[model samples]
Target: MSDLIDDPREGANEPEFTVSEISTAVKRTIEGTFDHVRIRGEVGRVVHARSGHLYFDIKDDRSVLGCTAWKGQVARLSVMPEEGMEIIATGRLTTFPNQSKYQMNVQDVAVAGEGALMAMLEKRKKKLAAEGLFDPARKQQIPFLPEVIGVITSPTGAVIRDILHRLRDRFPRKVLIWPVAVQGERCAPEVTRAIDGFNAFTAGGALPRPDLIIVARGGGSIEDLWGFNEESVARAAAASGIPLISAVGHETDTTLIDFASDLRAPTPTAAAELAVPVRAELLARLEEIESRRISAMRTALNYRGEKLRDLSRALPRVDALTAGAQQRLDLAAARLPGALTARVDRGRAALSEASGALRPSLLARTINSARERSEDRGKRLAPALERSSAAAQGDLARITKRFDTLSLAPQIDRRNDALAQLMRRFKQATEVAHSQRARKLDALDRLRLTLGYKATLERGFAVVRSAKGEVLTSTKLAKAHAVLDIEFADGTLSIGAKKTARPSASVSKKGTQGSLF
Candidate 1:
């Protein structure tokens, strides 16, 4: 009885415990008290860990509470945590024994209200806008008529059915459906992949590539349609090689993809309408154009025919034009003989008058006197002619002897020998020049063989080039997960470079060694 009384006060006072023991007790109590609780606060200091876990702080105007979502729970989260976003996090509160603090292990997270969702959306819009995804220059022009239209949406949803029905009503088109989750964690990645896949197809292949893509989904709350606002989906839309039409929701519903797309449709049906023109309207336009062309051609032909008829009426007859000329020729021919006879008679009369003016007796006397004078002059010139001939002969003989004394044959021979010597020297110089040029050409050929890129390829060395055809001599210019082309002597090989988890230490070491070498 004495021991029980002594120990009652002592046992109560001696109930002290170690730090770990007290922490364990507190952890259990807090975890049990806050099990399956929902907390509403604005998110702050969000951190996505490399392990796929999320760490964040949830705070009101009064105080803050640390929160954590494991990788598995994060996958199920409807809204990813962002700073200053009001959200409702559902989980259990637990204590960290090591740090002596308590936090919530979040099982799921969602936007608290419409206001919070809009605020988050606006924030994302600003971020994407800064990256130039919403630039007008980035937008493509929608094709007037697409041969194949790629549709990205849930196949079972009303959005696809509406789009197809509208297309059938207006103009039937070939549609390739890429069914994807429209409102979940899978939505963003599936849509992004669909856009990229459509672009990757080779044009004019067996499965013809789509000329236009329509990403459609029905109207929903901001949270339900949040996938369209994902950065990946927006960027994929912006970078699409094929023109894209964004029909994410109703006219009032807008998403980030709309800004990046080539055209934004108010509804799925409207997107189809924008894709192609009505067949009946097109046929009517073609018929009108054909009628106008036929009318113009007929008018032109009629004008030409009328002009030809007028020209024929204005033309003169060929026989009538030549009759006057023929008459003039006949008159000239008839008077030609008479005119010639008159001219001959006039010439004979003039000649007879001139003959009658002279006398034959006077002419005979003058001739007799002229003959006697000619005989006297001949006798006087004979002796002088003989003397002049003798002197000329002597001068000719002396000139002949002088020519024989100074002969040109030997001088001609000497000149020919000098010319031959010069010809031989010229030949030697030409041969020397030809040999020098040949040696220089041989040296140039050797230099080309040693310095040319083809020679390097022949030595089993390859040139690495990027997709843009720029030569890549170092890793700095090479992009991770990018394709590269290697040029060899035989052919070219295409390959992809994977990003290394850690940079190699040997890179720097080799660079130093290369510098030394």
Candidate 2:
């Protein structure tokens, strides 16, 4: 109906255009004029679009400004705008023609001031704490004496110097300095990388991996030390494989990394002190302990010697102890000769009394009586044997006649057929058992191949072995062997080291090996 009605004043002296044309012109004009600008405002409603775009309103008491950050730009934002948070947005301003609105296309974002930064820091701290990053259970105990200490800090700063000096004064140890920016924009990422780089090292490699890591920075304002407050830096500290000691800023100045680290130091100098004890003091204490041990040992020996002397004094003399046994032995010796003589006389008298019973005539009579009895028994046994043989022969002759009379061919044939049938069944059962065992053997072979490490060698991996055919699991162990066998997918490689001296199993040394086996 509105399209049908025509205006009477269609042609006028003033210039005119369509709504789209005017909007396009306005869009171009506004974008050209305010191509780049920074706007500081308090964040209002924020919308994280499903398409990875961030839409939000920045408003003050009077007016509101619309801001948007696309997916590509959102990741680069130092501070992601949150509700009720103040932020300074840096981007180009452009108007939307269709919607008849103007919006700021945010390229970067940051907290407006220290207050906002503190607010963000507090919020992040709460979030990370809720995730248990700061839990005491996750904190690792510091090594009593770390052989290698990795220091992460700026190379040009006196903080690292102070740490090294303090470490030198206390203890001498290997220090791996990972130079990184300790302040400003590059600080967080560089520090994080330093931590990860230290952790990536393999033990006993060409470069010795650190037993402990120290992240350090000098004292400064919150803004100067903001890098340690970054979430990435804190998470890196928490996730460090090596135990990390955070020594950033002064004692009173706490950062997020301090909470996530295994230990916190008041200053960079203090971190070194925590790493190890003073060498001179340790030596002195050891000497004192050794002195105490020697003194105690001497005291024990003296006490034992006194007790032994007292016991010896209380003991009877050797001659006194043997006197009673010697007297008794002498008494027995005096009676032994007379007793032996009496025994001999009694034996002679007994022999004389029994001499008459062993005469020649008496022996001859006894032999004749035994011979007569033996001859009678032999005659009776021969007759019994003859009668039993005759009876056996008669029975055998009778059974032979009965066997000849019966037909035995059919029973013999039946027995043969049954035997053949049993043989056939046994053969079939043997075949079935053999087949089952063969299948099981094949399955076992496949399982062995699957479980073996050779198949995995094709995937850019190799199995390292010592010359003694042992699988070397660690670099230190591999280095211990002069010859290494590296098995790849295609073949095996045997390589020799510069110095190939295989250690002997015999622990025997001249006066050094212990007496106990």
Candidate 3:
């Protein structure tokens, strides 16, 4: 229902129109005054009419208004609209007759303040480039096999959903979410806080450091998307130890954060695609590479095979050269056995001839020599016996003559002379025999001393014999309770052996000597 304004000066003089008339007139006045009216708002309850018309609400913090756009106008949008899309609509105001409502007939619809966003983004890009943040030198490479990935984005937003979906599909890895407001006045600080928090968390060893960071959000109006353009956000991204990939807006949209980041991607999903390689496409490429590698290997193998075949063909010549050597060997091999047999036969024949020729003559000569030696010995023995008999007879005759003469001349004087001569001869014979017997006795005494065991002990030494009759020189040979016979010059004495004392304890100095003997 519409209410009419009251006039204070002429309350009764004014004529009252119907609510519809007032609303229609008002709508007409507004449409006529403004050639184009543009209003910015967030899209809500958006509905596409079947009649090629789109109906939605333009809303802000204070108010909401109805809006409609023809399909022709909607076609110009680079993106599809869902709830909470910020947009600017330029159209004339109109009123619905049946519903009695004011609504906008949008001639043109576009994202609001994108020019400002672009201009700011370009300026920031230049600024960051000057600061070397946007320079390629500052960009870090994302690890192909990262253990963990850090995501700086809205806790509950479509961007996260897209990212998780892509990451799960491409490659599943640990993802740590540092939730932050992505679109608001509080978004910059939250984003900066998240970057710092992630860095701190990694530094404290509570979490593994991120190999890559994804700073992303869904598409929005320039104002809603302004958080990514903040200097703090850019610096945070630039200073993040990890490599950063910025994904903020639709494919056609670009932001200052994108420039500052190591890599820029148009959309959250595209960013995910960039972060990880597609498994199917990568496998296909690997297979292609493997195929090419195998082809190269086969080509190399074939070349080597051809070279081997050429070498194999030349082997016959080598074999022919070797054949001459084989022939010489064969000739040697054939002649060796016959030559050996002939040499053996010759040796045997020579040995047989020598044996045959030497045996009879050697026997005959040996027999003749034996006979001649026997006859010569017989002749010598006969002559020696005859000369020995003659010498015996002459000695007997001389003895007889001396005896006879002595008998005849002997009287008292003769007897006395003979007796003196005999005495002198007897004395000389006794002296000579006594001398020879003394020498013999001395030789026999030396022999007896050498053979006697008592001879060793007679020289101021003791012969210590063990019970087993072995000579015990060392005390180690006689244990405790062992009976040993100590043979000295006078007698043999038996004593029981005792354990030998240790060297250190048994030893004494000159002045500190004790009697133990």
The residue-by-residue lDDT of candidate 2 on 1-517, one tens digit each, is: 9899867685666888899989989988989999999999999999999999999999999999999999988766766688988988899999877688999999988788989888888998999999999999999999999999999999999998998998999998999999999887678889999999999999989999999999999999998898899988999999998999999999999999999999999999899899989999999999999999999999999999999999999999999999999999999999999999999999999998898777899888888888988999999999999999999999999999998998998998999999899899999999999999999999999898888876688677888888888998876677677888878899988887554444444754552322100
lDDT of 1 by residue, 323-395 (tens): 9999999999999999899999999999998887567987788888999999999997998899999999999
Higher TM-score: candidate 1 or 3? 1
**Sorted on TM-score, highest at the top, how do the candidates line up?**
2, 1, 3
Name every residue pair that clashes in candidate 2. Answer: none
lDDT of 3 by residue, 1-517 (tens): 2357655675677888998788778778877876479888877888988888788898999998898777887754333344666777788787777787778888766555666346545656777778887777877887776668899888787789889999999977789998888876568888888887776664548678777888889887777877777787889888887778888898776667887788888898988888887777879999999999999999999999999999888777767779999999999999999999999999999999988867888889989999999999998999899999999999999999888778565487788999999999999999999999999999999999987866876777787788777887665565533677777899877766543233455556643422111
Candidate 2 RMSD to the correct structure:
23.9
Number of the candidate with higher TM-score, 1 or 2: 2
- Cα misplacement distance, residue 209 of candidate 1 (Å): 1.2
Question: Candidate 3 versus the native: TM-score?
Answer: 0.43
Model 1: residues >4 Å from true position, as ranges? 1-16, 310-315, 320-517
- Sliding window of 10 residues with minimal summed lDDT for model 1: 508-517
**Backbone atom clashes (below 3 Å) for every candidate:** 0, 0, 0
What lDDT is reached at residue 231 by model 3? Answer: 80
- TM-scores for all candidates: the values are 0.59, 0.64, 0.43
Q: Candidate 1 lDDT (Cα, whole model)?
A: 0.90
Alpha-carbon local distance difference test for all models = 0.90, 0.90, 0.79
Against the hidden true structure, what lDDT does model 2 obtain? Answer: 0.90
